[model samples]
Target: MSRAFTREVDDAPPPPILERAISSARNLVTPNGARQIEQAMETLDRQIEASGDSEALAALRRELRYWHARHARMEIVEPPEAPTIVTFGTHVTIKRGGEPKHLHIVGEDEADPAVGTIAWTSPLARALEGARPGDVVEFQAGGREEEILVLSVKGASQ
Candidate 1:
């Protein structure tokens, strides 16, 4: 084939897929959150070592990159010196419609609502940040506004 008919670029493999958005920007994290990031890196490293499948290794590497970036810029913030209200790394129990619900306000990467944790940047958490026990906070959910009564506060998570 002539030079004009052949292309060198076609011989090269496509670039690896990456989730770069996950690795951008630093964020405040709790000690546990920082630990979680470290744990994730460790887990990915082990998986990458043990996996023989190319696809699995690629996925693990992508996860490792995310965790590495997270760990690199993670800023660990201590819990409130004196706990009088809700803040990052603390669990706040609140009641809506007399039904109690507990939410752990944590770093963005540690948020898992199924386990009762929410990111501090979430709307509900933002509204509840400066509130104390017995304080009522108005939160919007599903396009509707509701009131939540703070029942208690759990000490910061380790």
Candidate 2:
């Protein structure tokens, strides 16, 4: 039982959605996510040791674990607070190309462009950040420049 458990842990890739979320979270330096990754690594390490795996498996696990740990340590600065200006975690309403929309400027990990959660590093987010209500912003993407007008900026809580 222990051997099988070990082998399974050794062979398993990090959960895909978790990895994507973690990768995105890493880009923003979310302390909570970093801690979660550390805890997960510790769990994986114990499993690998108990499995008594071959040297190759051990090495692979070690490398993957190290990569996750190193990535968690990358610096991610928090977005500045601008109640009136759009920033990370801020919910902004805008009119883009004649369509009205609401978007949340979030960390890379939390970005879901399809659902209007944009990463702070994305061109749209970068262009929108620091903008206040009534401000007009022009962003160029895919070889074309698009214009948007900030209609409102509010905290995530609201």
Candidate 3:
């Protein structure tokens, strides 16, 4: 090969971007979760308007679409006035291995396990759903079944 014999294609179109995956589970969201989704869409819109790069715009647009879909399918589930059982939009306290863990059952989009929020459709939440105080639930984790004792279930605000 001689000096500079390769041809760079500058006019070629960029690769197509993949769309975000949408969950098939019920799109139940808490009031706060709905607000978070709206905020995300708004932020994305601003970024899309300010972006000058095509690739960046594409990514922003893709994200916006995801948020839009989530917003469209969002079913706001209000917290019960006095939650007596573990359910969506409820705060649950469970005792496992002699340790008490507090978790909020919320929508998938706003779930952050690090902050003690779990998606309603998650295995732990599913296992806890409908469980009342003093009830022991069997939860499968890491290929082992663990017992979780429901200590208390209350409204998210409480």
Which candidate tops TM-score? 3
| Tens-digit lDDT track of model 1 for 1-158 | 68899888898886787775762434789888889989988888989999999887888888898888888788998766557789887778999878999988888898899999898888888999989999999998999999999998877532
lDDT of 3 by residue, 69-94 (tens): 99999999998979888889888999
Candidate 1, poorest ten consecutive residues by summed lDDT: 17-26
Model 2, global lDDT? 0.70
TM values, all candidates:
0.81, 0.57, 0.91
Candidate 3 global TM-score: 0.91
The prediction achieving the highest lDDT against the true structure is 3
Q: lDDT tens digits, residues 1-158, model 2?
A: 56655766778875432222234334563444355456667777677767765664556476566647556555654444558788766789999979999997765544678998787788888899899999999989889988899999987345
Error of 1 at 102 (Å): 1.7
Which pairs of residues clash in candidate 2, taking residues 3 or more apart in a chain or in different chains?
A: 24-109
Q: What is the C-alpha lDDT of each candidate?
A: 0.84, 0.70, 0.93
The per-residue C-alpha lDDT of model 3 at residue 104 equals: 94
